[model samples]
Target chain A: MISDSIANAPVPAAAPNPKDFAKKKRTNRSAKLKQCKLDARREQWLSQVKNKGSKDESNGFRDSSMHERDGSDRSLENLEMRQRGEENDGSIHHDSDLESPSNSPTSNASSVLGGNHSGTNYTGSSSSSSSSVGCCSGCITEEEEDDGCLDDWEAVADALAADDKQQNPSSDSSPDHEPVARSDSLPELTNRVDSVVQVSKPECAVMVPRAQVNGQAWRPDDAFRPQSLPNLSKQYSFPMNSDRHYGRGAVSWAHKSVISAPSSCPICYEDLDITDSSFLPCLCGFRLCLFCHKRILEDDGRCPGCRKPYDLEPVEGEASLNGGSLTFRLARSCSMITRS
Target chain B: MVDFARVQKELQECNRDVEVSGIKVSPKADKLTHLIGTIPGPLGTPYEGGTFEIDIQLPDGYPFEPPRMQFSTKVWHPNISSQSGAICLDILKDQWSPALTLKTALLSVQALLSAPQPDDPQDAVVAQQYLREYQTFVSTARYWTEAFAKTSSLGVEEKVQKLVEMGFPEALVRSTLEVVGGDENLALEKLCTV
Candidate 1:
């Protein structure tokens, strides 16, 4: 919470010089993006290192697949974009996003529509390779959907069975005959399988802008614009925009959420005069009366509002400067040693 | 700054409607930082007719920070510590919002008396009893309420008189009674230690 205020306090400070502020903000954003990229790469490297000791063959396969995806990098970009959609929920908007599935599902569907819109057709080799990855993601989605209905898992099992059939085409050269027999036996199951196949197919070649138009019809105010970017930059930059919005707006949101000038002490439930010297130390903006503040500090310097430790930087600095060591550098070193 | 002005106002506001709310707040000492809160046990529960006293300590960040409150009156319940009288309610900790007052908090405490959340318990033994032997837990809670909370009842006076008869001076017995908030068994325990 304190970090949030530290991030946004400068926005209002630099408001007078709008041009400089904008430039500085952009640079700050880029720096954040670079940091995120480094963090992702570091995590990937750590995971790879961990896996290398256990399964060298699996690592080789993963590396080869990554290389193969790199050739038709557009498909790889699409996958990354979808992954970003998944990551968005895990980050800043986690609470609200999970609470409101209607919002995320529609947005996801729109983005998928946009992806298909941007890329007309995937090359045969790229399509085949991406289909496997897509199937895995489809299975994951199916698992998530299973929470809503038990039948979704059955549908996913059927999809997996079809996948197994595809892998062993030599054993059952008449794979088409089995699927047809199953489809005829259970039309409803065939319909579910059809939806699953559509999800896994990278060659959805057509984008229906009209689907997005229908979505917009329900909520005209929702700015549901279709994405047309077909390259890696489009997918890569998606997270950057989200990260920028999340970093800036979410900070301001937290900063604004707290009652900076509360009318009363929340603990005692008493009204205070506007001029009372309050202990508005933490970003939670909870104020303590002087007596309460002194009493609390006597026990521990945690913010009563949130039970966070008081950031005692100035106090620590003063202690180091005044007591024990007289020489300033020596005092600093002594304080550091004592602190450790 | 213990917003003495606000605390004074809250005390007045809380005590003013004691008849209606059955919740009262008063300063324990001259300082506003330390206070006492009284919440009548919720109606129609095992704690019915019992008055629960809660110790209130105002931290530095009074309104922003949640007020520190613990049960001074010991009774059997899952969410309240059987030994220390520490309550395990969300509002008394991180879930506390500034919008809540001492009166509201006391009301919440009273509500907790009626509805003990065994799933998130301060006393694991009590919670287990509540979940596994619910009828036994209720009777035990009711018995504790009768033994401790009913200060006006002759049963408590008899216990106090009996302790005094056992050669503990009347003043020490009375003082122990006050310390244990009229819990006969606990007062006897305190007097025995003395």
Candidate 2:
């Protein structure tokens, strides 16, 4: 699971190292090395944390004050060792602390390292972790734990733990806050986060990131590149498949409201990069690209979101994009959206 | 597929106001798709003083498709099945919208307890009794709630006997127990209020 998170971390940008700029491909190799080191440290940190938690649990009843003293002493030792490690690794200590996992030895280590690393590398990781911990941890965890269904819950518990740390500073601070650059892949990030987490302690999973967690799962990995969506102007609105609704006289004003078209269709999961024209037969917040809309109407005019019988009517309005009609024609050429 | 991002958000949003709403949602196990929602029965209803559990299953086409929900706790309501606990709410089926959430849906379920739709019955027998024999329905619902929903912390008999010996009739003590769902203190409060 830790390795998964390390893999997803943006390879520290090589732009700062002028020599690496000329050797772009080599920068990838160096980033891989850094990730490898981070992974190793993460495992070491996790093992230490497990040991600490077990020790605390077992020794809690005997004499809690004594146990707390011992725990703090050990924490101080760990901090000293981390500082030594940082000296050996340079600013990499700051990097590691920023992406530190919670209930972690690094949290102890970072408190000491913070005095030194706070000045230079504090902005990105510290601010992001402090601010986005409640919201982004689940998202980052879900995205990282794509294959492990059960780990999603752990991630959620971890998110709750993060919240607890935020609410009451006495609890363990989450060390693993990798500042993911959202602007580069906002939609893709949303798609990945949308995969969901397996929450072991559902009670703790609070504070939903509304903008990112709105349920729109973007699937057009190839089509959603920022460069492809150049002309937002030429998009045209298409009426629902004429065959879907027979009774509504094709001209009812009630059915004429235009859907604020989504960039992609739910039916085809295709982005408007290729097919710009979209139609929504109902105001149920679901849109099908013109191709899927036509097919649904031809077969059955039922709204998928709300199973009510639906009909599409073309409204005379300002055309949104130029490539709308062409995109519909393109989608018509392929039969990828036939019902099961 | 399942809108997991929405699920995560819904959980966070639902849990944030847990204190105010007294509604809780958590994964049944590790899986996000299967969840359990807990709602306290509304005040001034047959189900008052009880807690109800709901089972939630997120479909692959979630947000696009409504979540499948059923009463995990045995509920005596017209729109909820007494046997299988299937709910008869439209939002769970054909009347769903992508905009609606698991929290909202559970809120609706809680509301259904206060204002039951006997006309659209999931359990015909319960609905029929609810309409025809409203008094019997209330007593039976209260009794069932006391039997099933309660988790009495105090030894119930001592409290019941104590209340009975305090000059209240034994029948009144028992009925108060049914009304307060076995909370000794609440039953005493009901006795005092009456």
Candidate 3:
């Protein structure tokens, strides 16, 4: 939301010299876009590391066909555009877009509409592809595992169906069909598949347009049942147009539907780092990221997932940052320390 | 704050299944904290066919704090105030849960329209009529729904014409509708008094 204001905040009351204001805004936008890009990439790495657990668990719910749609190089573009859609829900009137650059709604639309695939995709703007994360290699391996997980899910789903009568529909549908049959179920499985796809496809292609991203992240987000984004999160609002008319609601909806990397927080719908420590669960099994879980705890100690108050006593030897178990905190801190 | 992100997701989620729920929520303006929700009046009730609008105000602690909802469109019901439009529904007050989104809360409000609790009344007059003069209450409630529900949506000209067709002079209908801010039903009620 901060990036939206930075990129799209209306002119100050004491409007500056038009030319100077335009230049200043341009410089500010570029810097913000660059920072946002880095943040998106960094957040991507953090989520990937945090979500190592998602690979095995998140697979059962994903549509295996969406992996086929994972067009590789959209990463950098989506990394930037997706965040733009997430934080910047302010209307992106065409006039304002013309004046601002980078995080302008126009830039996101341009990328999402396939306008920049050849020339100015976010990857091209990023010069440091070989950074410590070995950006390109990490992304490739992630996609490779994404495919591996698809195959894994196919067999695992079959195995689960053979074992359990109530095997989840998402798991069983695939591995039963050739890849062609799988595509037919795409529209129906899109919601569940997108959630799985959100987890596995995180590294390479995050922007399926939230039309592809909606509440597919946290299963318990569906606890509300009446109004959960899990199924609708995949719609990227089609027009990420900076139409001054589109509020932040439509923007994030647009953002998630377009490109979602991390599994999203059920409460906020912002991408979640879904690790055991980052993603906390209620006794009733409602899962939310630590940020929202902590906020709920602070508010009334009621879990949004279960509508029941949770036990606040911290677990043994674990001083929680919020309500989570913090099993990986030491490992994360060590890694952060070593990396920095 | 209002957890605008969740509000956004809720908006997307709620509007997506509008066909099923027949409930739609949109921001009153840019602020997610204030919203306008529309619910079709419950079936098999005096309210059927009318679209009721609800004005929603999200407290800073929303989802944690129940969203404050009152009818924007006037309605005659035991648990809802006719003058102030304050709703005396349990879910809107202490019984609310974070698990409840605007959509679900609105659903409960719609449910209340069908099954009213005259014993726990927000408007004593409406409750008294409901319990004492059951037939009078249904007609009055139905009349109120017709007048209240269609008032905002019907154009002044259409209302003027409708009243004119009902035997009022065209000039009288126009002036009366204008006096009542184009509320044809109110105009009709006034013309009868005249």
Candidate 3, B1-194: lDDT as tens digits: 78887898899999999999889998877788889898999989999989888989999987678999999788999999998789999888877877678999999999999999999999999999999999999999899888778665788788887888889999988888777656565688789989
Question: Which candidate do you rate higher for TM-score, 1 or 3?
Answer: 3
Ranking by TM-score: 3, 1, 2
Candidate 3 residue lDDT tens string, A41-135: 45445544655764432432232211211111122223335333312211212212232211222323433333234222322111111010111
Q: What tens digits encode model 1's per-residue C-alpha lDDT throughout B36-155?
A: 898887889999998777889998777656799988777899999988889999988867765578898888988888888999999999999999999999999999888667753556
Query: Hey, what RMSD does candidate 3 come out at?
Result: 33.9
Worst 10 residues of 3 chain B by lDDT: B177-186
Q: Rate the local accuracy (lDDT) of all candidates.
A: 0.52, 0.50, 0.53
Give DockQ for candidates 1 onward, in order: 0.11, 0.05, 0.33
On the 0 to 100 scale, the lDDT of residue A198 in model 1 is: 35
- In terms of lDDT, model 3 sits at 0.53
**Candidate 2 — which residues are off by over 4 angstroms?**
A1-310, A314-340, B152-194
Candidate 3 stretches with Cα past 4 Å from truth are A1-263, A276-280, A312-340, B159-194
Candidate 2 lDDT tens digits, B1-194: 67576687788889999999989898876789999888898999999998887889988767666789998677889999987789999988877755477888899999999999999999999999999999999998998777556644346777678788788999899989887556565576579989
Clashes of 3: 27
Local accuracy of candidate 2 as per-residue lDDT tens digits, A33-112? 35444454455445435445333221111121111112222222222232332232323223323442332223223432
